[model samples]
Target: MSDVDQSQLFEFLCRMGDNTLVLGHRVSEWCGHAPVLEEDIALANTALDLIGQTQMWLGLAGEVEDKSRSADDLAMLRDVWDFRNVLLVEQPNGDFGQTMMRQFLFDAWHLAMLKALTGSCDDRIAAIAAKSVKEVQYHVERSGDTVVGLGDGTSESHRRMQKALDLLWPYVGEMFVADAVDEAMAKAGVAPDPATLRDAFDARVEAVLTDATLTIPDGGFAHKGGKTGFQHSEHLGHLLTQMQWLQRAYPGATW
Candidate 1:
């Protein structure tokens, strides 16, 4: 690969890593505040798994970039616009229903992407994907089950859950849009073509939604951006301010 290609790959990996790290942090905020104790524990566990994956991916990204910065540095120091994650992950956890719905959508996509990534020619990324797929698979199952229960439970629960799903649906398109950087890495077998995973992702998500007795929203505008060099939703800026404050204030400090 050319120098430019390698640079793009490194940046791309960091974006992927940072997205997980930031979203994990956001989810962790609900640790003690979930509607049920079981759910609190489940969300907390999933958050930890995501953060663990973020550490691995960010470390690999740092190595590829030949940078001395640690995963913490890469995660906590980046500006909002610099973040490469799809907007779905960063959307606010509005309520328990919303959170579960968001997780269901994001994790389905994540599982498909990671499954394909397991065969990447970039051994570092492939190894990370192989290790992470186990945890993410479980996350998808748990979140999908929650969505089903809520969506098919009481009428109120079903209404709220469906609304949550509708709110999050627009952000789904950004996940599968492969850009120049993605194409370059894919050509080198360093990255999976995310588009290839879309059908599988749709099938998995559709199965879950069908089981939940939920109707997939049809032909909404499908909001896009926050990947391939586009601006993020406003929520991301507030998230970054809170996440980066300590790192920026105490530059080299350690706990």
Candidate 2:
């Protein structure tokens, strides 16, 4: 691969790893605080799965860049602006319904992405996707069921779910907006084209929304950036401060 191609692939891998790591951290915050014990366990497991995937993806990213940095270095040392996670994952988790809505939306896209990637020409990516897709399947099932139940339940539950959906829909756009790196990766069969996943993602989302008795919002503005390692929601900096404090304060300290 050319230097430019390797650079783009590195950026693409960073984006994937960063998204999972940040979202896992966000979900991990729900530990011991979920509405019930079962949910607490469930969220923690999901968070663990995401973070585990981060190790593999970011480990490969470091190798691709020929950098001596480890995955721990990438995860713990990067500044907020250096993260390439989509805006959706970094959005503040609100009520229970909001968190599920966010998870459901992401799981839908994530599953599609991983499934496509299982066939990637890049063997490492294909291997990772094959393993991770099973975990994402469970994530989708859990979050999708929660979405439908809350959306179709009591009037208040229904209202809250709808509100969460509307609030989150705007950020969903960023997941599908392909840039140069995305185009390059797709050309190399190292990644799937985000555009190609749109139709299936829309259908899957619509099926859940229909069953949930929820209406898709009309004409909300879409948020972008985060893939560029430049723009982020204000929440990311705060999240990083909490997440990176120990590493920054005590670099190279080992258990």
Name the top TM-score candidate. Answer: 2
Q: What TM-score does model 2 achieve against the real structure?
A: 0.97
**Displacement of the residue 157 alpha carbon in candidate 1, Å:** 0.6
lDDT of 2: 0.92
Please give the lDDT score at residue 197 for candidate 2: 92
Candidate lDDT scores, in order, read: 0.86, 0.92
Clashing pairs in 2: none
Residue 194 in candidate 2, Cα distance off native in Å: 0.5
Evaluated against the true structure, the overall lDDT of model 1 is: 0.86
Best by lDDT: 2
Alpha-carbon RMSD, each predicted model: 1.5, 1.2
What are the per-residue Cα lDDT tens digits for candidate 1 across 1-255? 443376888878976797688779889989899988988998899999999999999898888888687788788877887788888888899989999899989899889888888988777788999999999999999999999999999999999999998889999888888888888878888777778888998999999999999998888466677876488899989887777888788887789
Q: Candidate 2, 41: how far from true, in Å?
A: 0.5
Model 1: lowest-lDDT 10 consecutive positions: 1-10
**Each prediction's TM-score versus the true structure:** 0.96, 0.97
